[model samples]
Target: MLDANLKTQLQGYLTRLQQPIELVAALDDGAKSAEVRELLDEIVALSDKITLREDPTGSARKPSFVVQRVGQPMGIRFAGIPLGHEFTSLVLALLQAGGHPPKVDADVIEQIKALPGKYAFEVFISLSCHNCPDVVQALNLMAVLNPNVSTTMIDGALFQNEVEDRQIMGVPAVYLNGELFGQGRMTIEEIIAKLDTGAAARDAEKISAKEAFDVLVVGGGPAGSAAAIYAARKGIRTGVLAERFGGQVMDTLGIENFISVKATEGPKLAMALEEHVKEYGVDIMNLQRASALVPVDGGIEVKLENGAVVKSKTVVLATGARWRNMNVPGEAEFRTKGVAYCPHCDGPLFRGKRVAVIGGGNSGVEAAIDLAGIVAHVTLLEFDSQLRADAVLQKKLRSLPNVDIIVSAQTTEVTGTDKVNGLKYKDRVSGEEKRIELEGIFVQIGLVPNTDWLKGTVNLSPRGEIEVDAKGQTSLPGVFAAGDCTTVPYKQIIIAMGEGSKASLSAFDHLIRTSAA
Candidate 1:
C-alpha cells in the first residue's frame, strides 16, 4: 500500500531506509492507524526480510550511513527529508523515534520554544562534507517541527555565483536573523542559542562581484567540462571553477576504456577536454572554492572562499568525486614520492621495482594488472578475505605473472623517511605482522565525494551524496546539481558527463522561464 508515486519521486534517494527492528518489538499487535499507517505497517513488515550489504562494491549497494575516520561506514536512519530549520528538527524527530540526540542545554531549549511560528531560513551544503549532511538533516527536521521555518538547499557546485556573493568559505553555514551563525558541527541547542542571540545572519547586497551571468558550473572533471561545453555551445554564458585545471582524471595515469580513445593518460585527457571547453569561451577559474549564497530579489548572490562574489540567475553544480585518502602517517608525506594514491599516475615510475596496491577492488586489481605489465612485482592487499571486484577482472589479475593477491591483509603502518621504502601490514586471520619492501604504494582504498565545502547549504544523502530529482533539480529553486556528487549508481566518467549535461539543460530551462517571466 505504499505510494508508488512518492517512491518514484524519491527513486534517486541515495540510501535505503533501514528500519530498526526494535520499532516493532514493542508493538505487540496493539498499535493501530488508518490506511496511511497500514502502509507503514506493510513497509515495516517487508523490512524484516531486508539486510544491508557489508560491501558497496556490488550493484544496488547501500550508502554509508556515517563517515568514519578509517573510511568504514556510519549506520543511522531519519524517516523524513531535510530542508531549512527542519534540519534541526531531525534531531527532535529522531529523539522521539528512540535515538540519542546530540546533547542540548535546558536554557537553549527554552529559547527554541520561545520562537514565533513565522520566520524564513535557508541552509546551503556540499555532499563531500562528512558532517554537512547531518547538519542539513538537522536543519530540515527543525523546519518540519516548526511551521514558521522554510529551508532550501543551495548546492555549492551548482550555485557558485550565489556562493561567491555571500563571502562564504565553509559548509553548513546558517544565516539567521540577518547575521551569520555557526559553520561546522552544531547541536540543536547550539543553533538555538545562536538564533536567540541574534547571530549568524547577513544583509543582502553586502557581497560584491554583482556581474550577471547565465550559467556557472563548479568542478573541472569530465562532468564539469561537459556542462561547460554544452552550455557554451547553446549560446549560454558559461564559467567553470576548479581546484585545478583538470579534475580526478588529471590524477588518473591511463584510461584505455574511454570511447574513441585506445590509450590515454588522465592528465592528457583532462587537457584535451579543457582545451575544447576553453575554445568555446567558457570562463575558467582554477583553485577556487565557493563559500556562501544569499537569496536576493532578482537572483542569488554567491560568495567564494577567497572572498570574491558573483550573482547569477541559474547555477549548475558539477564538483565531481575526489580520491579517498589513506589516513596513514607516511601516506600523505610520500603521496608523489613513494606513497601514491593512483596507480595510473605513478605506475611507470616503479618500473622494475616492487610495488604495493592497497586495495583489492576493481580499481586496485586493475591498477595491479596495469602495474604488473610495467613493474617486476605487484602486491595487491585486501582487508577482506576475498576481492570485491568482477570475476573477469579477478581472473585477469590472477593471470598476471607478477601480481600477488594477499587476502585479509590490512596496512597497519607506512614506514618511510622521505620516499616510501616499505609498508608494515597486519594479517587479519593470523595476527602476524610483516614489513613488505616496495618502491611505490597505491592507495585505492575508496573515494570521498568533493563536498566538504558544501555544508549548511544543500541537501545531501546520508552518504554525502547530493540529492537531486530525476531531472537533476537540487533543493533550491534556481539551482541544479549532477555528476558524482549526486546519488547515482555507476560512477563512470561518461555517466557523470551525462548527468552534468542534464543539469545544465535543467538550469537553462529555469533560466528561460525566469527570463520569460
Candidate 2:
C-alpha cells in the first residue's frame, strides 16, 4: 500500500526500534481486511524487529489491528486503514510500541505511569480531519506509557453503525469507559489535566513562583509566537502564556497563501512556529487562559483561570480570534451533535446525509463545495442579497448539482431532539419561514477577537477588538496588542507576524524610555 519513497521513509523510521514488536490483526474475510493484511505485510517487511500475526478472535471489531511489544498486553488499536492524516499516528504507534522513547516531557511521562485507575479510551475519527491525529496520538502515548490505559482509534466513516449508535456527529469524538469524554482537538497535557484533577493546582503553584518577565506575550498563535521570538532575540526575558499554543490555527486545514511557502497544513505550520520560538530563550506556558489583567507597581499582572498570576514589565496581547457562533437557540446544545464549524473535519461524518451551510462568504461557499462531494445535498444560505465569495468560488459552487443557494436568508434556530435533524431560517425578501431537513449544520460566518478578558483594562473598539496606535501601543502604557485581537485591518498570517514584530519593538522602546526616566 506504501509507495517507493514512503517505503524508504518507513524503513528509516523502523530502524530505530529497540525491541521486538508484533502487529496482531483480528480481521474477517473481507476486502478491507485484505487491504489491512497487505498493509501489515508491507510494514513488517521494513524491519526485522517487526512481525505480523493473524488472530481473527483477538477483537470483536473486524479488520482491526493491535500494536504492542511482543510479550506485552494489548494497548493501541486501529480499526480502519490508518492513512491520510492518521498515517503519522500509525507510524508513531509502531515506533513507540517497538520501544522507541517518545519526546514527551519527563514529568508527563511520570504522571501517566502513576495514574491509579484504568482508562479505556475510544476515539471516533474521520480521515480528513486534521485535528484527529493529535487526540489519537495522545491517547496512544498514554496507553503505551501505562499498562492500565488502553486506546482504540475507530474510523467513523468505516464503522458507520458505531458512529450512529453513539450519536457521534463530529470528528475526534473521545469516549472514556464507553461514556462521552470530549470532542475536539486535545493535547497530551490537556488530557492529563482532565484526568488528574490536582494537576491544575500544581501547575498554578509552579506558575506563581516564576520570576517576572521582561516581555510577556499572551496567546500562542502566529502573532504570539512572533512577538515572543522578537522579544527574546532582544536579550529580554520573554514568556508566552497561551490557552492553547497555535490557537484557532490548529483547527485550520489548508494554507496556500502563507507568503514564500507555496502550500502547507495548519498543524504543520504551527509546529514550525513552536520549534522556531523554542530556538530562543523564551519561556512558553501552554494551556493557560488569561482571566484578567491587573496593573501592578511597574508591571502588569495577568491572572490565569487557575488562579495563577504572572507579572511582566511589558505585555503584548496577541490572543487571536476564534470561529464566530450563530448564537441561535439549540446551537450551543447541539455543538458536537450536528452543529460544526469545520467542514474538512466533520464533513465525512455526514456523508450521504443532507446538510446546510450558513453564510455567503468564501468559507461558506468553499464548505458547500467540499460537502457537496461527500453529503447527499448542501443548502447554502446567505443573509445578504448575494454571495460575498470570490467569483471563482461562486462559479464552482454554482456548478455543483447537489448544492442549493438561497439569498437573503437568515438562520433562526437549529432543530433536533437527540442530534441535528433540521434547521429553521427566515426568507428576508419574501418574509417567510422555512425549514430544511438536514443531519448537519456548518456555520461559516466569521471570527470574534479573544479580547473579552481585557474589557475594563484597556481601550476596546465597539467590536471588542483591542484599540492600538500605529506603533502597536494600546491605551495602557507599556501594553501593546496585535493580530486579530487588535484593530489591525487584515487578519492574514503574514500580517499578524509583522504586527507582532512591530508590537515587540514598540514594547522594548517603551521599556527603555521609561527606565531612563
Q: In terms of TM-score, which candidate is strongest?
A: 2
Q: Which stretches of candidate 1 lie over 4 Å from their true place?
A: 1-210, 260-265, 430-434
| CA-lDDT, candidates in order | 0.62, 0.94
Each candidate's number of clashing pairs is 66, 0
Best by lDDT: 2
Alpha-carbon RMSD, each predicted model = 25.0, 0.8
Candidate 2 has its poorest 10 consecutive residues by lDDT at: 245-254
lDDT of 1 by residue, 62-162 (tens): 11111111222212222212222233333233332232333443544455557665545445454333345545555544553454554444444334454
Model 2 agreement with the true structure over 220-262: per-residue lDDT tens digits:
9999999999999999899999999998789788899998999
- Candidate 2: which pairs clash? none
TM-score of 2: 0.99
